[model samples]
Target: MIRKIKLLLLLSVFAIGTAVADEGMWLPSLIHKLNINTMQQMGCELSADDIYSINHSSLKDAIVALDHGSCTAEVVSKDGLLLTNHHCGFGEIQQHSSVEHDYLEDGFWAMSREEELPNPGKTVTFLISVEDVTAKVLENVNDDMTEEERNKAVRKTLDQLTKEAKGDSHYEVYARDFFNSNQYFVFVTETFRDVRLVGAPPQALGKFGGDTDNWMWPRHTNDFSMFRIYCGPDGLPADYSKDNVPYQPKHSLPISLKGVKEGDFAMVFGYPGSTSRYKTSYGIDYTMKVTNTARVEVREKKLDIISEYMASSQKAKIQYASKHARSANYYKNAIGMNEALTKLKVIDQKKALEDEFTAWVNADQARKAKYGEALGLIENYYSDVENDKAREFMTEALLRGPEIFTFAYRVKPMVEMLKDPESNKDRIERYAEFLKIMADDFFKDYDASTDEKVSAALMKIYAQETKPALQPTCYQEIQKKYKGDYEKFAAQMFNKTVFDNKEEYLAFLDNPSPKVLEKDLAFQTAVQIYEKYNEIRNLVDARSDILEKGERLFVAGLMEMQPNKKFYPDANSTMRLTYGKVLDYDPRDGVTYKYYTTTDGYLEKEIPGDYEFNVPARMKELLLAKDFGQYADADGKLHACFITNNDITGGNSGSPVINGKGELIGVAFDGNWEAMSGDLAFEENLQRCINVDIRFVLWVIDVYAGADHLIDEMQIIR
Candidate 1:
């Protein structure tokens, strides 16, 4: 299964020895100093100030962070009409969906303002500014201080600084560390709480090819979704209200129907989440062997159970669509990432880097005193992998696997609240109300039969794979009482458990008692799982300080050793800019993938009856007519999706793919499967960012869905 031969055949380069051209997610504030000249040389017509500036309107004003960097969106209309990926907005879409409405199947479009759907917790965050506060945050900590004391000092400083930053403003302030706590920055942001769902295409169009096409090239998925932000008459953020009006943003990106070509300048601006490009080889090995492998095994089984039920019922299809897609997305990524990392020999390359670092330290006594033990610390910690494997299996197979245990765990706070009702009367009342909301949400998507099957298989897997001592108390009870017959035990538990019905559960909460909860099988199982989880966590915690300090020192030493190389800080859910040109790649010896996919490609891949490939009759008719309107290229081909070499990660989903003139061309949604290892090490030639072209987005909106009224709000250029 090792693909080193294929790797050698495809790539002439041995391994990613260092950062190469078009790498690094540079901070927007530092673009002038770091990336502007190179970007212009590549084809960019915009200046640094045009991309990011405080005194005037800039591209940053249009880019918004959704739910604190979970995804990105851009303003496309003067009235705050927003555009992001279908998958990014899937949760809200699922929440509004029902068996009757079936919004996920037949998409929703708000013809007017009154028809728009409002989501409760959804918010669009705009970055006002960021300032370095490292010296202030670390002012009270010392090297000699213990980790606990150091944390306390840092928290106190951050709290004070955040308070100073907020003042009388309504903006939210966040201070986060960079480079494993070696640097820090305070961010000021304004968040609009009233975000309304405007339009989306049906899954047949938006999620075309679903899991099979995710993270792969030649994608035809029109992954875009639309939303709008509303503000008060004063043009400030406000909660959802009838009185609120459409927000007039400082800037909006113009959509260019003039499509992307090979080697065209492309830039992505978004809030990228975490990446451990500075991780030690030991850490990479642990991820590959334990974490990634465990996920691959567990999620595949989970997906099988869900997929079976989803195929049989439309209810299951809507309920588990989000959950299934999430699990499957990472499942494929892990399988591909493990193979890519091994084939690329990233671990060996990292070892060579560390060896050179060791030599550099040995040459100087002061350097040795500072960094000599960093690698040893990492090695000693990772040597405990034998202990870590069982913990991973137990977590994946038991703690997170069963839905009943997870639901029962929610009652832990309610149990404590009932214990002292007189002193916590108000809190208990509030929690009871919250319990109703919780039940409504969970049971909407709950299929008890599916969970029962999943629980039985996972329980047996946990029993078979784990050591006797590592198994939870519940497993021990299973062995003694049921003789390890998970099927019989699951049947009894599902039939007898109060959690199987919301009405019975709520009736008990009306006059809850500790004895009632103590005898509950689901609650009992959850407690045992948590007890073992804490045991493993404590075991890991005992050695974590050394590991943490070692990681910090390793990055510091790497920066020192390669002083001439331009080093960008690792992403930590902060805004960044990565620029590259649109290009194609050869995944294998005889196969070369084109940079862009077209409408004809969509018709070519249809499977007739498959939901992933099937489309609406209207869409097929439009394609047959070849009436793309203004969204086709000079060659008269309708481009659907395209690729660029822009450096991006998970949180960059829904980010705006901007052209040299600061016009929107696409929305980034996924990364290529070949270089899934880019999270650990950047493979410059193989790594690619996948985007849905803006032209295809509009084509689907205006022609396929007949939502041309929504198109009237945008500034589109032919």
Candidate 2:
């Protein structure tokens, strides 16, 4: 068939070429073909086989994609001891904490196996294998097919391929796209579900500087947490079970007590969530202008609403801590990223690159035919900044900004199931029970007064800032229902909606009815917002299709134009290896930052009464004791944190920072404030990866927490 011939034409293997140090989230499996030489030449002592060999256990085995790849964790001991960032495990920690047991305020340490807490929904997945399945995926895809048809073909291939790959096997399979769907690969993974919390330093140590110190350099956050995995007696994945045994990992990284030095080879191995180095200039501007601004503004208002309640009540603080932290993180990141993008003139750079690309395309008939419309299509789509802003703010304000909308959206699905004419009673009852459980979790963290204030404020912004026509029908209903008084509107919705009152909410589930649900205020608001959401979405999706194809061709054309320049795919929440060095830099004109920070810096930043900077008594005593046991650096001082030039992003948090010999020396935690724009453009000198020196993590574990049984499990290096 014609499809078969097209598939054969595209079946050529991807070969390894050179790449830059500051960019690229390279696939581990392709290290043997693409990155091995550069990595070795840059002082990597290990061979490619040691990094990602499929036929043997390699460094990849020690790394795990935590909870569907939101973050990364590393195996540190044979008995499945896992180490990750405190914030990554903050949700679980918060789940276990209460007014009586304030673990967030005063950390948790398990002295015995019985003391460790089990997390029901928590899971850790290990990469079993990765193989390219691009040819099979694209066999049915052709240049003449519509984008939707092509997408369907690819999806079908992926589903079929995944089914075949996993066929009755315990392993889960994923067929992920690379380079904007230009290439494809299948990843097989084993997920261990019986994950338990082993130990964690109190918030004082784990989140030392709090929000003020999140993405900044010269940092002093003890941003690490500990957990353990349990599996069946046969060493396979299992759900939480009291009888399950500790999982013996395929490989566990050996902890190194010796700390990193400036210019030392540092390589981070983990699942980096995403990056857009190849994103079209349209995306960059859309984000930099309307999207980022909308995010920062709306989140600031949302934070104000939540923080008022969180500040006065201990229970609310514990309940909303994770939610607040998650929201505030990207809120701050957006603030800095907007500033960095403008200051760095990244837009200019992108425009220049596109300029050259246009000239290159127009220089030849064949190139013109292939890439002629790419730049114009991108530029023309992004030209409508007002409409883009309207679309973006509607999403930020109505769809995502308010918390109530979350439950409202979910209610729609349940309502649909209720409306099914021949709905099974048993199925409906089970669904009803599930809704009850969901309501419990929602109300446990819900404060209607706070959410009402937030919803009111954000809805005002949505109404005023966006075009009147672009505003959701809820806005018009607010006018007709409550004379545009947001507080009155929110009050009415919350007061009447079954969602706010728990008992009433669950009672309705006993005999769920479509007629009653349709009249529900919250459900009606969800319907109106979703309707408006789709209208704008249709407007965006039409342009997005053109942008997507243009971008795909732009990237391919860019690679061809500069054949000598090494190319790598963007990060897509898959396992990748990015290598660099432990080096400090001058972030601004006259100031220079050191490569590492010690416990001395920790004490200097501490304030007795300040919640963000308060130092604990034991921590001060240990520092004054002038001894770190065996966890101190070569200079006999305890290094709390260190800096690296390793390229990383959000999901790389808690990733293992390995030395030349494949030893875990630190955990990549944060990036410098100077390079908030690193994801858009890699700043070779200013962009630094902030990591917690493994020495600090171990010191807190073995000495501060006195969890020797946990420490004894690890293969510690002197």
Candidate 3:
């Protein structure tokens, strides 16, 4: 009788799979699963076979390389020309900017190949391949082990794998969970450490639209930057080398002059950062309603403060640029998410799915007994955290408040000690690293007034909410020590002359004196504050474990409830491929957008005398002269269009849009406003990415900038 019952239970699980088999949310088994028949029903089309043939040829040749700071770039030329988004290369570009050069304002051009600027310590990576290693990863974890134990064991196993596989190269290996931890895939990446800047457009061109048009559609932004990857004589990856040559790529997308039209098939291929469609209704609703709203409000308030301060001072404007950019991005995402949730009715769908899963779990006696208690635990914890969210934010603010001031104080003492002959080697070396970091910060366009305002506000927030025992008199201490002499302090700390050579600084960290240790209190304080937060965060995380486990079981039950069907798990920053074609839209309230815009639109959108929207005189002249030449599309309208149905997000900016023929068509920049909810739930009804046509890029190089030498290297096709 027991054996018969077990067989019946297994049969029931198989039965459920058949029910959900038809849902479009299932993970596709192959690339062809994204064809027109399947995707078109969701408003995407398959590219023609000829186009696919071409794109496959080109895409296979493009080498996927990771850039410095976890960003990605692609090598597009044999001479080591690299392409990435302006924002991705913003730091490097800013490093080269100065009062005389002002590269940020006027842009940079290599008058000749030899004149290209070189940046030290920047690197790029190439993704080799992926393999399934789930069995090896989870071999030590048994069903009897607690979730924490399982997690620790899995982490240790993956770390061992990475260490053993790393070899002598600077490669990185990631053990990624797939299908909600039911499976796993391991990725091995080869990284090159030598990368340098080649050229970049001025902020006016690269970030032309700025804050106003940032998240809005019908954009005319030209957000591109150039870099080069350097390698040793043996064609192996190397650190910064003056004698290095450009690393050759297995694939470089050819430039295409074919413009996209309405209903034309388009696809994008790149690493998308994340998505959260499989989340519980509780989580999804909270993000869409509570978190997003609060985030937008915070950013809006911050932006107002920044704008007010910047208007009165030039230094303030520069200092607040980074803050403004960060806030603007969040604000844009919040607004987009709100719009998408409403359009897709995501909350309702999530609730319905949850309800179905709940019914399934309750029907099974074993599942009911196991998850029944877990569900209550999850709910209780979520309620507690919801009440304490504001307190948590306040605590985080206090911990980060003294970051700048601490660096300023520590750098001076470290530099002085390093210059001494008796300085410890290890101590000096550590100080040198700190100095390098300080240099990066000092070079940044920082607005003193804005920083002061932010500091004041943060301190006030901390004072109001923090427990007295945990609070520090940071603001008072800062004022007392600096005594309105921040400029002198900054100069002493960052001036290269004071620090002398790197060797001297390395010695200071090794034989640190009492004074140096006392000065390092900021670092100590930071560590202590982080530890406190970590304790609280870990408690919350423990509670969240119950929620995750319950959700996973619910997902499994849902899967079992439907037979012969597949469902793709939520994205967790792993590599994924989404396919689609280019198409136009009629969003709402009589708003009609074409699949592609022309150079005329870019010029027409320019407001005369407006610093943000105004086009440079030279670019305007080129546009008026109709010097499109060979870059014009098939329609003779200057092929400034292409299409794709690739799934992407913020990290996907500057990703190449390749055709089936394996030719470059455009660069992915942003998603349409209607698809902002795509990060949470992909709605085939609205999600589409916007890209800058490669022809537009070519035209900018050939006509506007007269960079014919750069243009001659590309395999431009009609």
Candidate 4:
């Protein structure tokens, strides 16, 4: 029976083989086959025949959009309509909403082009291409060098490369890696720093069901957003400009009314952030068994505290969003990691692979002697940092939140004092700068009571966790300055009395007030104590360098061990191509996930009382009428969703789901439940990428929202 179950599982996975793992990172020779120079000349697009000849020069125009929160977006519509995941744009949508006009509750419609709200300070960048500058980058560092020296060498090389290659152009250069340690790619990116928000669906529609429904299948979330990149008078990227024109992209995915069917070949194009599946079996096992569990525990605990406070006050909600977002991310990761590890039997497979490698190494005397102690060193280092990691997260959260808030309000006047004299400028500039930032935060319609509660809770945590020697100096100073009354101190510090009267807030800046500077000194002292904690972390990281090196060696050894089985190192926030076909999934326990869902699914998931899943009346009306029109699939089902075998994570959210024709079919969003572990391990066994079918996006614009004008601007292919 057990064997039968395993066989069934394997068969099910094979049915979705495109979504499953292969030996190494799957780079279709089709994309990389062409030479870099030809690709650049062709503007990053190629014919099937041309794809066969791709080379290093071909990659020059393929840009890497890095450090995006969830996923990067590409411009798809000529009229400045941007495509990105619904979740990535959720925050911006919610930010633009209010109680009176509950965009989150009912969704949004632009009505006309002018009605589109402008997003300030949002930017999208494109890498024009990359060049090999390894010799330029590594000129200062030898193979055998200290970490500090290596870091310095890398910095100098990057600085020189940027200085030389930039040549007065508005481009940023970055050094990247390929094929693990064997190759390097230097990307020169044309950064469109002036990106603006276009439109986004409300949170209820975009992030429907929240964490509970996250990573699950048969999902009904309409996770999509729109943004526009802007350029200056010269048609080049410039700083914020009200008169800036919309950027003209070299390529844009045309909206496809012809929807996908099961088994149809599809691909996702974008920058996928990071993954760790290529680590040693020992590392993977340790992460799954120990690191993931501890991480989950810490996040759950932190979430509990955040939820409690957020539920009580709106101020707490705003203050804790940054904290909550981080906690939720880790919590989600832990859950996904646990599921992936268990489903893949990652530990067992890792053990088997490790055993085979050990046998091979032991038979080779020289290699055996070199690598015998590597695993031990890794194990010892992981164990040492295990306890400290959790505390570090907790500590960082406390410092970032209420503690930072308290210090900011207390030291506002000292920031104003720094402008008094140049000599005092150097000493007080950093603190003054910090205080100004805090003032902006404190005065921003924050709930005083909730801030106080968070501050008090954090103080207690600090008291409990801080070393004895450090506590007295820090807390004593705070207590002495605030008269041993935290509540009173908070009340006086964050009071809007000074700021509510604009004249006073601005005037406070003019006066070189000694009384205000005293309070600032108190806060400065607290910041210093926080700095001490950071110093300790730096020390810990320094000591762990040896272990990190050993782990890297172990990883290298394992890769070498898998000689014939093409193995790729883990993703390091670079652009990658994942190819697969549209397909459905049968997760387990008789549950099956269809490859595509329709507009009707949104209504089906609607719960009248549940805010997250509750559908707006108009949305329900549109679905009930079956008004899909041109967007309807051939079978008459309104094409609302589809699936792909793309290996993606957070940063891949807003990626374009393209066909072989390079047309946009859907906007990439979440991955299936079985594939949540894709971040840790790309389980060829079950992971599948989920996307909002482009048909659904058009349907929402044309039929549901009645924004036919917006639809008309797009290059729609029926």
TM-score of each: 0.95, 0.95, 0.81, 0.81
List model 3 lDDT by residue over 1-718, tens digit each: 0011111122111111122211222222223333335544544433333222322333423544345224445567776677777766777776676656767667777767577777766767665555555668757776577777877887888788777767675667777765445455566666778777777777777877777777666777777888877789888888876788878776666676766656554455555566665566667666765567656654564567677876674445445555566567768888888977887777787777667757766888986765445345445546655423543444435443323443434554454555664645666666667667655445365544454555445545544444543444443444467553433333332332212233433454434454543454334334444545566565667576676565544555555555434355455544444556676666777876767777777787888756478888877887788767777766666544333445667656667775545566777777777778777666554556777777777777766667788877767777
| Winner of 2 and 4 under TM-score | 2
- Over 627-715, each residue of candidate 1 has an lDDT whose tens digit, in order, gives 98899888898898999999999889999999999999999999998888988888888889999989999988898878898899999
Cα lDDT listed for each candidate: 0.84, 0.83, 0.59, 0.59
Model 1 lDDT at residue 397: 81
Candidate 3, residue 649: Cα displacement in angstroms equals 1.1
Ranking by lDDT: 1, 2, 3, 4
Best by lDDT: 1
Each prediction's RMSD over C-alphas, in Å, is 5.1, 3.2, 6.6, 7.3
Candidate 4 per-residue C-alpha lDDT over 1-718 given as tens digits, one digit per residue, 9 for 90 to 100: 0011111111111111132332123333324432223333423344533322223322212222523334677666554467676666555555555556656555666665456665544556665655655455545665377556666776777777767777787677676644323234466667666665666665656776667777666777777767666678788878766777877665566677778877666666667677765455656666676557655644565567667876774444545444466568657867877876787676676566567667877888877765666566666776665335434544543455454434444544465556565667664655545545545544553444555555554554555454544342546655678665655654554463343333454455544455554554335444555555566566567666666556545655554554333344355655555556777767877977778777677777788856358776777777888867788889887766677666677677777777656677888877777766666556664678888888877777677667687677788887
- Residues 1-718 of candidate 2 have per-residue lDDT tens digits of 0112223222211112223564567888887777778778878899998998878889999999899898999999999899999999999999899899999989999888888899988889999888887777777877788667888888998998898889899998998887667778899999999999988899989999999998998988899999999999988998888899999987899988877788888899998887787766677888887878898988899888888889987898898898889989989999898888788888887777778878998999988887787677677777776666887787778777777877867766666566564756677777778877778778877787888888889989888888778877778878887898998898888876787767777778877878767778777887888888888888777777767776766766776676555566678899999898888899779999999999898999988967689999998998999878787778889998999888899999899999988999999999888889877777776788899999899888888888888888889888
Worst 10 residues of 4 by lDDT: 1-10
- Candidate 2 TM-score, C-alpha based: 0.95
